[model samples]
Target: MKTLGIIGGLGPESTLDYYQRIIALYRERTGDRHYPEFVIVSVDLRKGLDFMDANDLGGMANYLLESIDKLARAGADFGIISANTPHIVFDEVAPRLPIPLISIVEATRAAAKAQNLKRLALFGTRYTMQASFYPKVFARDGIELLVPDLQDMDYIHDKYMNELVPGKFLADTRAGLLAIVDRMKATSDIDGVILAGTELPLILRDPIHDGIPFLDTTKIHVEAAIAHMLS
Candidate 1:
């Protein structure tokens, strides 16, 4: 198997999720007694957020690129970033990385296309939702992406930074997020919800909600990384 490199700790909570899930799923899939070999470089969460908050995408790309370089030097065969928002600069950074960097967006897009999903509601940080990257990528396959209204976007971003990133999964916040999805399904005819944020699946664990599937990006990304490793 190829050595998998992960640029993690975009937030500490989701980084742990990526590590645990990759090990568990890899074991189950291969029926192996031993775990897959991998490397992780956990960067500062605050620095990344600062880059986004300042609209300094170039800085963000360079920051992630530096982390990926560390993974390469440490002997990773390929790399993947653990968070969604950093993917705003994925195109900028992937080409420069020494190892192949698997994209969370492309992986999710393939999953949606396989399911024949026409439209998906995206939930993530403000940088992810407001950015055109996800919509543009999905649109290549004729899939449409919808984000919450400005007010809901604000709420999602606030809770994401303050609660989800910090590992505080509250019932009221979960309910509020579900309500947003329900509205999108009703009004926009969405077939799926993209838990675009890695930490999202931690709070919204169920695969399906109100007949619309919640595409756990962390799971999809881990599966993609494992596939690349085994291949």
Candidate 2:
């Protein structure tokens, strides 16, 4: 098996999910009861959030690039950003990186296509919802991706940073998210919902619930990374 490198701590909770899920899935597949060889470089979440707040995705890309470089130095065979919002800069950074970096958007796009989902409602940080990364990738497969209204976007992003990132999962917050999904169903012909934020599954972990499929980007990306590593 190849060594997998993860650029994590885009927020702490989701990074932990990636680390644990990868190990569990790898073992479940091969049943070796041995942990995989992997390197996790947890970047400062503040730095990335700072750039995001300033709307300087270029600076965010530079921040992530620095981490990827270190992962390369540490002998990582391939790399992945552990969060979705930072992937707004993926196209700009992946080409410049020294190793292959798996993209959450691309992985989710493939999964949606396999499920034959034509229209999807996306919920994530403000950046991920507004970014062109997902639209471009999904467009290639003729999939329609819809985001929530501005007010709902604000609600989701706020709860994500303030509550989810800090490992705070309140019942009220989960209810708020489910309510948003219900509104989305009423307003759009969405066949499924895409949990574009890695932390989202921490709250809404079920794939099929609330009258629509929820595509967990973290699971999609992790499964793809496992295949790459095992192959």
Candidate 3:
């Protein structure tokens, strides 16, 4: 099996999820005791979060590029950054890395298209929702992306970074998230809600949408990586 490289630790909880998911999927497919070799380059989430909160694009880009280079030097075959927000710097990171960087944007877009979705709601970091990176890519694929309202976006950012990422999953946070989903369902008429954050699935497993689908980017990303390796 081919080795995979992950640029992770944008938040530790989701990073752990990605690591476990990759191992489990690989084992399930091959039914071999040996697992695929992988490397993880976990950067300082606090710094990345601070830069994103400040809209410091240059800082974010530089951090991501450096992280990718580190992963390349550490012998990663191909790389994927686990966080959705950091993908905003993908354009900068891709060319600088010695190894190929698998794009979450492409993976998510492919998943959305496979579902024949024309419009999708997104729940992710503020950088992902407010920035042009993810939404623009989806738009190019002719899919309309709907983000939460400003207040909701703020709530998500705070709850995720302060609580969920820290492994502090509370009942109130879950209730708040469900409420946000409810509001989006009522307002957007979207075919699906994309759980763009890696940590999101930790809070919402088997998410029910009263009929609408929920696109779990973390699962989609892992499936794509496995497919790439097995193919």
Candidate 2: regions farther than 4 A off: none
What lDDT score goes with residue 54 in model 2?
96
For each candidate, what is the lDDT? 0.94, 0.92, 0.85
Model 3, position 24, has a per-residue lDDT of 97
**Reference-based lDDT, residue 216, model 3:** 87
What is the model-wide C-alpha lDDT for candidate 3?
A: 0.85
Q: Which ten residues in a row have the lowest lDDT in candidate 3?
A: 204-213
Per-model root-mean-square deviation over C-alphas: 0.7, 0.9, 1.4
Put down candidate 2 lDDT per residue, 1-231, tens digits, no spaces: 788999999899999999999999999888886889999999999988899889998899898999999999999999899999888989899789988999898899999999999989989999889888888899999999999999999999999999999999998999999998898888897899999999999999777776799999899999999999999
Of 2 and 3, which scores higher on lDDT? 2
Task: Evaluate model 2: give its lDDT.
Answer: 0.92
Listed per model in order, the count of residue pairs whose N, CA or C atoms clash below 3 Å is 0, 0, 0
Encode model 1's per-residue lDDT on 83-123: one tens digit a residue: 99999999898678899999999999999999999989999
Ten residues in sequence with the least summed lDDT for candidate 2: 204-213
lDDT of 1 at 131: 92
Error of 2 at 69 (Å): 0.7
Of the candidates shown, which would achieve the greatest TM-score relative to the real structure? 1
